[model samples]
Target: MTEIIDYGRFADRLAAPRPRWDLLREFQDEWGYTVPAGVDPWPKWSESEHHAYVRALHEEWTGEEEDPFQGVDRTLPVPKALDEWWDLPFNSFTYSPRLYWTNPEYPLTLRPDPSGYGVSEGLPEPNPFVEPGGDLRLCCFMAEYEYCNEWAYLASEAGHDDPRVLASVGEDGWVLQARSISEFFVLLAAVRLPSHFGWSVQLGDDDFPDGPPVRERIEAAYRPMGFQNWRELGADTALFGGPDVIVRHDTGMADFAVEISGRSRDALAATARTLGWTWDEDLVEPPRKDEESQ
Candidate 1:
């Protein structure tokens, strides 16, 4: 059986510095959770503000005349430290076909917190994709990307026997990252809060120093295909051979070129063609004169 890690004890772990992934995995295994794929760095807001915003959303979604949070104790049973964290923006794993409810007449009125990535749940209609449970409701959403945005939520079952769950609704319900909303913030922060907090993923050890130097290559080869940050697309695939290191684009564009560098044209070309991308024969720098002389 997976051992249950006490929430307070986990907070102690977060009090220390360490790799985000390591801490996240530890939490997941101990708490029986998993997070979404990508990260969104939203800004922070006060707890009252968050609750107010969500209540407003519920009002908007249901077109209700009454206040949703009025006289209602929709409080979560989590550590006081975690509760305090709800003020920060929502930083969650990515979701596809980004979901956002825009009010053209008053879009800015219900705008996300200062970081511009806060998610608020107000819709009375439950997401059909998510299985019906104890008062499952949308919490907030990440920035929109690839036609959709990832959203987080709270369920009644959350914090009961199960840890508070903050999940995203996709084709498949991603319940893996379910933890008290406080835990969600703590996990992300423990790893490393994004500089933009609500705009991007935090940089782990692998992203720094010299891990996958695919960004420059992507700009050179696949920028036209709407390729942007490495975190957004994650690592597609890495090829090692003539070009030394070749990175493929995961930008969902068929014509994106394979990144290339090195003098081995024939080998690189063969590999590119086999992989179904047009090859850049000129990618290889000319062999150095000293090497040529050898």
Candidate 2:
């Protein structure tokens, strides 16, 4: 019979170099796994308790000497599956990106381009809610893997109620919603315009010039709706190739195609105007007709 170790306490002690080594030996004996000597076991540890332990150890090493882990139990009940769960990083092994199909014939695919970069493909036909000849595409900006998962879950749940909302799961395990220019703008505004909500935005490849006019328009549109500071919420990643404007907030991020046009363009512009947005000719584009027949 295996003796159950108090995981919480084990995690606390496992932060120290000496304790960490001893814990590894204990694991090796208890679970029959080889722990390489001299490795920083903290980084490999998965539980929140382990993270706390590592953080404590770091503080001690830095002479901070704050026992942040004080009052935390040194041991807690270890799940029988603990070894299995710890075998690999939790996020690495379990995170799945999938597009649940409302229409089975239109299965999505993850295709790598010539450069070996992969993107989600197989978008279904445009939603009729979008005016004819309108452009429909969505660009999702994700920094953390977990956020991507959240987006996927939200989108999947939304799609069940709204067939107009289509999603494709990317190789990176993100659900990229296939949305019309209008739908994308609406969703963007919905998330950004709300006062308590947090999100970020960037210009997509389809956006041009990416100048102040566009930025001003977005800011004005989102401000009255209660959007926080656009600049501070924006991401600094090269993904947007340095968007003319970036909006960052607490929960999610978006890449805006400011210059794209479709029947929904007027609706998008209207929404912006309603939010007090002002834009120049360069920041606007004539709406295009659906070229599906062409």
Candidate 3:
């Protein structure tokens, strides 16, 4: 039987060393950044409570279900250095599922066997000591990985194991994606924007010099809508905000193509007018007509 530990107290001690990651601000500054309306800040679950929840999960696995927790040498020990992680409120700018760890709607428990990354699902069988095999130590319930059990964000229990690594138990074998939690953040921040959003950039050229006129107009278009990708519109054309952005140079001001709906589009268009740029509402018309002919 695993003994319950004081997770909250441990988290307090660990908080001192954890990096002060302002993920929200970083996400907002990136181009094509968007978040849902009901965003709550971090520390969603208290450490003591969440650890109790995890222990309960272990009980469920070991009780009647077939002892999924059996024979794994690597136990999910509360690490002295990483107790702060359990207290973090998981929030991704675009994706909502990252926040589902404590969400009542999704449920907090993880099921093994076919539904999870288990031996039946291409993972290696369990061993006496926890080896990098079988299901990844479930960190949080990501909606993206709900269906697939191949890969997940894993926090190794043993101090000898990679402190924080993304482990994958695929058809090939167990592979680690990120070497450390710091490396994982870099990977998470670099995820591509979803296809639904349109991307384009405005630039000042001979026709529209990079001056107050251009800046003010861009502001009028972008600022009022609360679109916070201002760094992309900064003085330098060379710097790219992200993949979902358009970049323009010093010869002519190019029109922006936005995928937002209704009044937002109107506002952006109105702002473009300040720089003498026209919004071609009919640009998509020709393509639609062609598709209709087909």
lDDT of 2 at 237: 15
Clashing pairs in 3: 43-89, 73-129, 73-130, 74-130, 200-246, 201-246
Clashes per prediction? 26, 13, 6
Candidate 2 has a TM-score of: 0.20
Worst-scoring 10-residue span by lDDT in model 1: 97-106
lDDT of 3 by residue, 1-294 (tens): 022222113223223453534532333233234445455443433222333465478668878443333323334443332343333353342234342222210112232332333321222456322475544444432212232222233334334323443333334343444444433333333332211222222332333554555544433333221111211111111111211222222221213323221112333343345456545554321111111111
Per-residue C-alpha lDDT of model 2 across residues 109-210, encoded as one tens digit per residue:
112112111133322345433344543332222212222221111222222322223333343332333222122222332222211111122235334344
Q: Model 1, 278: alpha-carbon shift in Å?
A: 20
TM-scores of all candidate predictions against the true structure: 0.28, 0.20, 0.35
Worst 10 residues of 3 by lDDT: 230-239
Please, what is the whole-model Cα lDDT of each candidate in the order they appear? 0.32, 0.28, 0.32
Predictions ranked by TM-score, top down?
3, 1, 2
